[model samples]
Target: MHKIIVTGLTGFVGTNLKKYLSSYEIESLSVRYIPNQKIEINADAIIHLAGKAHDLKKVSRPNDYYEANFELTKQIFDSFLKSKATVFIFMSTVKAVADKVDGILTEDTVPNPKTHYGIAKQQAEEYVLGRKLPEGKRVYILRPCMIHGPENKGNLNLLYQLVAKGLPWPLAAFQNKRSFLSIENLCFLIKNLIENKMVVSGVYNCADDEVLSTNELVQIISLALKRKSRSIAVPKSIISTIAKIGDIIRFPLNSETIQKLTENYEVSNKKIKTALEIEKLPHTAQYGLERTIKSFINK
Candidate 1:
């Protein structure tokens, strides 16, 4: 059995990955940002998932992102270069490339991160690519967008709650499509990368093949709950004004949250799909999303 050492084992992605890769011998490694800290690798592959996620509330310090995302990644990657681990997978976010992608985001997109979280992750990606790997070692930097799955809690959960309470979605006026990554697809890609030596080492964006609008997502949530989907097409201007007020009053519908809800951030998984020699990911966007919504209802 291939032994895999995974960081951030307690996190959403890490927890799901552990369950998904049940055939592999998995070892959980706890990691935190400490200056000059070094890691010891004893497994055939290492999946680095431990890092500071983007702080939606804006309460995190700027240096905290650098320390945890960039510095910790640098330390662990340096260890991988020296150790016998044949595969090193770094979990990065699509935000590392661009917070707001104009068109479909591809592997060729140049990075221009807006937030500290994004910039820190971008730095880590550069560091990982800057080093030279041994003949037998392979490194893969995966940039996943808005991952969701069972037992996951985030904006998707918040949306599920709104639908569960029979509250009409108020942002239907704003039409936008966003890309999402299913945890199952992510785990499948990582397992393939670990087992398939023909796959090249480089940056690859991970996302479902299809993009869905917020309205469609609400419908999916409703379907999962066996309820009719309701949406109010209030004027965009009125919603913008309300969101501005929300920013000042600390309500849930602030400018940041509003932008997140109505953003056109589509990511392309073409490179990864071609590398894995597959026509499409195992799950469709609707299938993965419905599964996530059902999990929320079951809880």
Candidate 2:
């Protein structure tokens, strides 16, 4: 069995990835923020998931992103270069490229990250891609967008709570399509990358086959809860005014949240699908959302 060394083992993605790789012997590494620290990497493959996540509240310091995402990644990657580990998988984000996608985001999109979190991740990606690897080593930089699964307390969780309470979705007037990543599909790809030597080493965008609107997501959540979806097509101008007021008082329906709800951030997974030699993802968009909503309901 291939022994895998994983960082961020306690995180949502790491935990799910470890569980999915049940046949492999997985070891979790404890990482510190000290720069130039010597990391001990003794394994056949290394899955680097450890990084400072994007803070929606915008309360984190700029240096915190650099220390946790960029500096720590540089430190671990340096160690991987010298170690015998043949495969190195880094968990980068679509945020590293662009905060808002004008069109369907592809691997070739030129990155212009605005946030400190994204800038740090981009730096880490650059460091990994700029290195010259040994003959037997392979490196993969995966850029995943809006990952959702069980126990994820993200924007989806808030929507789940709203639908659970039988509240009407008010932003049905704004139509937008967004890409989402299923935890199961992500794990499948990671397993394939580890076992399949045919996949070329490079940057790949990871997402589900289909893109769905937020209104569609509301329907899915309602279906999972066995309830009727009440969608209200409130005027866009009216919603904007309310969001402006919300910004002043720091309410739930603020400008940022409004943009997130109504943004068209679609990502293309054609590159990864072609590399994996697969036609469709393991789970459909509605099916994956239903599974995630069911987990929230069960809890």
Candidate 3:
């Protein structure tokens, strides 16, 4: 049996990975520092998912991201180099690449991370990419976009509530295409990468093949909620002026909310597709979104 160690076993993605990887002898590791030498030496693969998530509230400490994301990752990765671990899978984010992409985000894009969260993740990628591993061993830096699936309780839930309550979405004036990764799809890729020996070491972007507009997302959400979509088209100019005021007033449609609603950053899954060399991934993007929405409705 393949021996694997998965950190952050309680996280959204890690929880998905653990249930999916149950066939393997996977150890659930929860640590803020380097793991034990015994586990370090014995594991066939190490999928590191533990890290400080991006703080949207902006109330978090400045260096917290660096300490939790960069320092902790560096500690484990450095120890992995000294151990017999054959594969080190680092869960990075497309945010580490760019704050805003002109088009689809690919593996080749230059990293220009905007937030402390993004910067810290990029620094961690740099730390791993800077090292050389033992022969036959490989490292993968996976930059996944906004991942959503079962048990997810964040901004998506708020959107779901709007759709569920049949509230007219005020941001329908915003038109943007965004890429989202299904936690199922991400786990599928990780399992495939670990199982396939020919899959070499390098950075890869992860997402479902499809890109959908936020309007389209709302429609899917509406379908799951079994309700009519009530997205409205207020004049953008008026909204922009109101948002400028709301920047101070902290209205729901303020600058940050506008960015969240209107920013178009479609991550390309083409590289990962070609890398895996399969005709289709496990789930379509729309299918995944609909599933997640339904999951929320059920909850």
Candidate 4:
């Protein structure tokens, strides 16, 4: 069995990934940002998932992002360069490239990250890529968008809660499609990257093949709850005004939340799929989403 060292084993993605890769010899490595700290790697592959997540609350300091995302990554990656670890997988976010996608985001898209979080991740990516790899070593930078799965308490969970409460979705007027990445698909891709020698090392955008509107997500939630989906096409202008008020009141419907609920951030997984030699991911968008919703309902 190929022993794999995984960081962030307690996080949503890390927990799911550990279960998904149960067949492999997995070791959990707890990491924190320590300046000039030397890390030791004793596995064939290391999946670096221990980084600061994008804070929607906006309470995190700018330096926190750089230290956790950039500095820690630089340190570990430096260790990988010297260690016997043959494979190094860095879990980067799509935000590292663009906060909002103008078109279907591809690997070719130039990075223009506006937030400190994105900028820090981008810096880590650059550091990894800028270094020359040793012979027989492979490095992969995965940019996943809106990863979701069981036990995930992201925006998707909030939406599921709204539907479970039988509250009508009020932002139906906003029509937008956003790409999502299933934890299963991400784990599958990572497993393939570790096991397959033919897979080239480079940046790859990870997302489900199909893009779904927020309305579609609501419907999925309702289906999982066995309840009728309800939506009100409140005017965009009216919703915008309400969201602005929410920003002042610190309510649930702030401007940031509104934009997140109604944004067209499509990511292309064509590169990853091609690398895996598969025409499509093992799970369809609906299938994966339904599974996620069911997990929410069961909980």
Candidate that would win on TM-score:
2
What's the count of clashing pairs in each model shown?
A: 0, 0, 0, 0
TM-score computed on alpha carbons, candidate 3: 0.95
lDDT of 3 by residue, 218-279 (tens): 88898887788887898988888878998988566687777777899888888777888887
lDDT at residue 147 of model 2 (Cα atoms)? 91
Off by over 4 Å in 4: none
TM-score, cand. 4 vs. native? 0.97
lDDT of 2 by residue, 206-249 (tens): 99889999999999999899999999999999999999999899
Q: Between prediction 1 and prediction 3, which has the larger TM-score?
A: 1
- Candidate 2 TM-score over all chains jointly: 0.98
* Candidate 2 colliding pairs: none
TM-score of each: 0.97, 0.98, 0.95, 0.97
Pick by TM-score: 3 or 4, better one: 4
Instruction: At residue 163, give the lDDT of candidate 1.
Output: 92
Off by over 4 Å in 1: none
Query: Candidates 2 and 4: which is better by lDDT?
Result: 2
